[model samples]
Target: MAIVLFALPLAVVVQRLYHDETVTGLERDATRIAAVVPDDLIQRPRPLKRPAGLPSRLTVGVYRVDGRRVTGQGPGRSALAVRGRDGRVHDGAEHGRLAVAAPVPSDEGVAAIVRVSAPYDPTGDRIQRALLAMAGLALAAVACASLLARYLARRLARPLERLTAAAQRLGAGNFSVRAPRSGVREADEAGIALEATARRLGTILERERAFSADVSHQLRTPLTGLLLGLESALERPGADLSAAIGTALDRGHRLQVIIDELLDLARDTEPARRHLDVPAELEEITLRWHGPLAAQGRRLVLDIQHPLPAVSTSPAALSQIMDVLLGNALQHGRGEVTVQAADVGGGIAIDVGDQGPGIAEDAPDIFARRSAHPSAPRGTGRDAGQAGTRTAAAAGHGIGLALARSLAEAEGGRLILRSSGPTVFTLFLPDTSMAS
Candidate 1:
């Protein structure tokens, strides 16, 4: 647009200037012709000596006042004489061609006129040539600029295009995909950041998959054992049918508890918290697990501090935590397993401990996902063969105890391994019964 604006008007001005200069030269030639012409020849038919090198295109005419050409013969000599005062050149047309006419002065004032003319084409040719040159230069410059701009834009846009494609793949669950870095500083930085995010997302998804596998394994083991135990008890001749069925039902209830705990762990939301009677809830849970532990020859002692302080926690979350602790106690624990409740300052404490050998020095990282040793008893062991009750989840210490601790913390409580000798796991929750 700018090229057009500047070039077109400039072409017009150059053409006009060239035409005006031609007119100026014609006027000067006309004045000289008038000065040399004799007065006697002006009123009568006469001719002057035409110069030897006279321009072929220049047309000069000396005309009488009545408009008759008398002096020199030229192209379009039939133009009328224009009378002008002083040396002023009067612009007029000679036939159809452009010409300059001026008065030839005599003692009596104006008597005849001298005119000069040339075809206007040569001046137009010069101007057109000059304008064409300017236009060519301008177009070349614009072409160069456009090429440079395209190159620079591709440099910047290529990296962004790769990033966009990688993002799409990642959103489609292809976390292994990565964006390659462009040499441009800004694009390289973005690629680096995007690659990091993909790695983090892949790691998180891997852990979740592993967690799911662990949960499935933990749940299926006990259910299998319970089925086996039920089949064995029912197969025996003269077995008490009611007792065997009752035991199978108890095992089914324990299996259900394991599922419930896993479900709670799977929930993305925090556990619900409210004022709960800690002692009453613990008492109920102990009784629920007492049957399976007794079947395994372990005594359960519920030692509750009278008038226990009410703790702020969800009953479901607290019950699951206790189940985890009690399950841990029953697997590797021996003798009497105790569910002891006490009121500490501003909180309630429940200690589920066992008189078993406890975590051995050899059982390091007892809370890891899998036990270090095959026979090593870790918190929340996965063996359900001992008792198909609340203590069902076995060895991986990874799922149950971790899930229990997570639930406790979510409900504004804490669960910790308080002692190794008695293998005591203590749960502390803030008392909120008096809170408004």
Candidate 2:
């Protein structure tokens, strides 16, 4: 478009220059001829006439000084110039004729002015041809531009169209829908961004679904137990009634704990940050559980390296994690349960090691909702077998290890089983620096 805008006027000006040059050359020729012609010729009985056998398209004429027509041939049109000097001039009416005049030099004085005119029809014909060629070229240019514009628009639109369709599919619950990659850098980048968003959304939905399912399964056992115990106590009357009521109360408490844990899980899934003192938090939880450890006749060892660094974490989450670990140790550990924290190269490292029968080789697989270990003793709860424990020697419900792992993850740390021996189970928690 820019090229056409600038080139059109330039082409017109060039054509006009070419036509003017042709007219000027013809006028110069006529002037020269008049200058060299004999002065007697002008005073003769008849004025000098145009040459014979001239092309019919060529019109010639002569005019007196006062604009009177003189003798000539070929249409004998009125002169284009009156008393003008020997120079090139254009006819206003004819447009294609060049007019010239020269003084007839004589010994006595200046005789009549010799004016001549010649047709400039060739200039018009050349301009017409040029205009026709220009029109043809312009048509070709328009055709090519249309084809190119359509091709480019289609090429650009195809990928975006696919992306729009994929987005619609995703909106309709097809989480797997993704855009096709094509086009230039910007288009490709947009496609990649859409793909990444889809993947993240799919992952989030899947995790939520799994968490909902796990929570439902975990709650069902306690709920069933509570219902049965309450029914039994209501139907019977004796010392057994009190025991049944107590059991019902215990089941209700366990149900409450499970609900709280689920709530914690949901909250931890959201993005947040907090600052904490690792040693102080650990000391507080351990002190809370010290009585339980003493009653179990197990020694509690806090081999914390001094000047432990402050960490960023959720205080409630960190406390819950430590409680779960200490509870597991006190319930199962036969001798000593050691809690240790120290500065590792990248971050702080905390370990909870228990002198209990170590975890089985299939511990990881067993630590899922609804999974059970038939060889190990079952707790009163239905899904207790699947809880993360070295063995089924715990004194209470079997959710300590699962809760510990959840709480650790909530605080931007992980509870990993470092090693399992015949009488030892060790868990390592990396500090918040490793969260991201």
Candidate 3:
């Protein structure tokens, strides 16, 4: 549109200038012919001699005052000839041609007229050709502009398209998706920002998934205790309903505490750290598991080797760690469960050991998030059975130990497997003598 707007006026001005120039040239030729005309030509009235060097398209005529053409070429009786005798130059269209007339001066102030005219067809054709050239140039400019615009649009649009796709994938829970780069600076920056956002969102969502697994694993034990109490009450004849209800309520309260602690963990907030009575905490945990262990024809033994120093950690966190270990032992171990607390290296160490076939020595990283120890060789005594247990723990058992280890570490401690045989998992709390 802009090209057309600019070219239209330019073409019009060019055409008008060319047309004026042509008429001016005709006027000039007429003046020159009139200057050479004899002042007595009006009286002589014979055919005038033709001039040299005039354009072939022009017709020159010398006419009497009465409008009779007595010249080389033109109409026999010309209206322009009669008008030209007024002793002035005149120009107008006559008989489909541009005609100009100039007067010859005599003592009587006006004499014969010299007229020059050119056919309109040639100048009209040239004007049309000029307009066609202008139109062609404008169309060429428009085509080039369109192609360049398309190239620019695609250059910017393709990356935006990929970024949009990446965003959609992110929305659809595909956080690992990445956006491709575009060379444009602004577009590249947007891509970089989007990728960074995806990574952060990926990490956030992963933490959420991990939190969910942790919650389910952590809550399973208390839920089991609650269900066991309710089932035992149902199975017993003439059971004391109030006492059973009281026990179930207690279990529910403990479950709620565990949930609060898990929420604190999920939010990445630090639960208040205080001096903990390791012996007392273990005693409570043992009591909670005693019924379930007894129902399986097993016993849970808690042994405090000596007077233990208070450890600094979140009490609920410690309870959760112990629950995971006890749960692991109950599900996989054979003989009685032994939980022993002792003072070791100024920090407290609590070992939960069982006699079931121990974890395989060749087990892959057990603390890794949801890592399945898939390749341990099968055999007896630290072979197929323990490997299967480890695989079960990794695969269907969810991330109980992994979450336990994380909770221990969050309280400035660590949990590890001290022995593959007899499967003793130890929880070590850093010494709290100074904090106390």
Candidate 4:
């Protein structure tokens, strides 16, 4: 549309300019012929000599003041010749041709007139040719602009298209899909934002699944123990019913604690850290695990080095981690299970070690979710039989240490296997004073 608007006016200007140039040439020729006229031509009414090198398309004539033409190939009576009698020049269309007249000057006011006329076809043809050239150039500009517009549109749209597809897949729960990159900055930034959203959604979903599994595994022991104690009390003749009820209540309370801690671990946001007294914390864990270990003829020992610094961590997280370690030792270790806490520079270090045939050299990744503990004894849990123990190596150890390690990292701490022979696992927490 813009091109047409510009080209239409430009075409008109070209046509007018060409026509005007032709008329200007005629006026120049007429003035030249008038200048060289013999002074007695108006009185004699004879032929005037045509100018040298006059254009063939142009016709020249000498006319009287009353519009009578004497010499020229044009109408005998010319209106333009009569109009030029007042010592002025005039130009207009005359008999389908362009004509211009210049008056001759004499001592007496007005004399003869010189007229030049030409057919309009040549001027019209040149104007038409010029307009055609302009139209062709306009069309070429339109074509180039169209191609450039298409290229720009696709460059801006392709990245958004990819992001749309990725978002659709993500909405459908395919969290693995990623957005593509384009060179455009705005589109690339949008794609990056979409990718970050996908990652967060994926992490939240994974944590939810882990939360469900964690609840089941962590609650299994206490729940089973509660049920088994109640069953035993019913089976025994004249059993202490009140004592059995009290034991069941304790086990139920423990289940609640496990649930609360698991919920804390499963949240998308990190919990606030608190200063923990290492020895005091371990003392409570030992009290809880002591009876369970004693029932299996094993002792739980808590040893602490003096002047232990306060470590920063979530209290529930710390408790759960200790519970997992103690539970593991109870189910699979021999002799004594010792929890040793000491002041290590820049941090506090705690080691949970057991006297048992440690993890096998071949089974290096015991903390992996799918890896079965090679040193786990036969028929470890309540529901396991001899046959179950035979295949226990194939039944992966649940996400106990893995959950513990994750919880520790959330508190900005580290958990690692410091030894294999004695099966000592070390947990290091940054000292709260040092952190400050």
Best model per TM-score = 4
Residues 30-50 of candidate 1 have per-residue lDDT tens digits of 787888777777646676765
Model 4, range 319-397, lDDT digits (tens) per residue?
8888777777766667899999888898889899999987777874767665343433333322322111111112344
Model 1 C-alpha RMSD vs. true structure (Å) is 7.9
Instruction: Kindly give the number of clashing pairs for every candidate.
Output: 6, 0, 2, 0
Worst 10 residues of 1 by lDDT: 376-385
Cα deviation of 340 in candidate 1 (Å)? Answer: 7.8
Cα lDDT tens digits, model 3, 1-436, are 7986899899899898878988899988888888789887766766676678878888888887788887568888889878987788888889889898888888887778888999988888989999999989988999999999999999989998988998899899887877777788888898888888888888766666788877865554456546666676777789887987886786677678778877877776565667787777888878877765665678889899887877888887887788778877877788899999998877899999999988777776767677333432223221221122111232333387888898888788989989988889999998888545
* Reference-based TM-score, model 2: 0.69
Candidate with better lDDT, 3 vs 4:
4
Query: lDDT (CA) for every model shown?
Result: 0.71, 0.58, 0.77, 0.78
Give the TM-score of each candidate. Answer: 0.58, 0.69, 0.57, 0.70
Candidate 3 regions exceeding 4 Å error are 50-52, 63-72, 77-88, 105-112, 142-175, 186-205, 231-240, 243-366, 370-398, 404-436
Query: What is the full ranking by TM-score, best candidate first?
Result: 4, 2, 1, 3
Q: List the residue pairs that clash in candidate 2.
A: none
> Which ranges in model 4 have alpha carbons more than 4 Å from their true place?
61-95, 106-113, 147-211, 225-257, 270-316, 334-338, 342-346, 354-365, 370-398, 409-413, 430-436
By the TM-score metric, which is better: model 2 or model 4?
A: 4
Ten residues in sequence with the least summed lDDT for candidate 2: 385-394
The numbered model that scores best in lDDT is 4
**What is the alpha-carbon lDDT for the whole of candidate 2?**
0.58
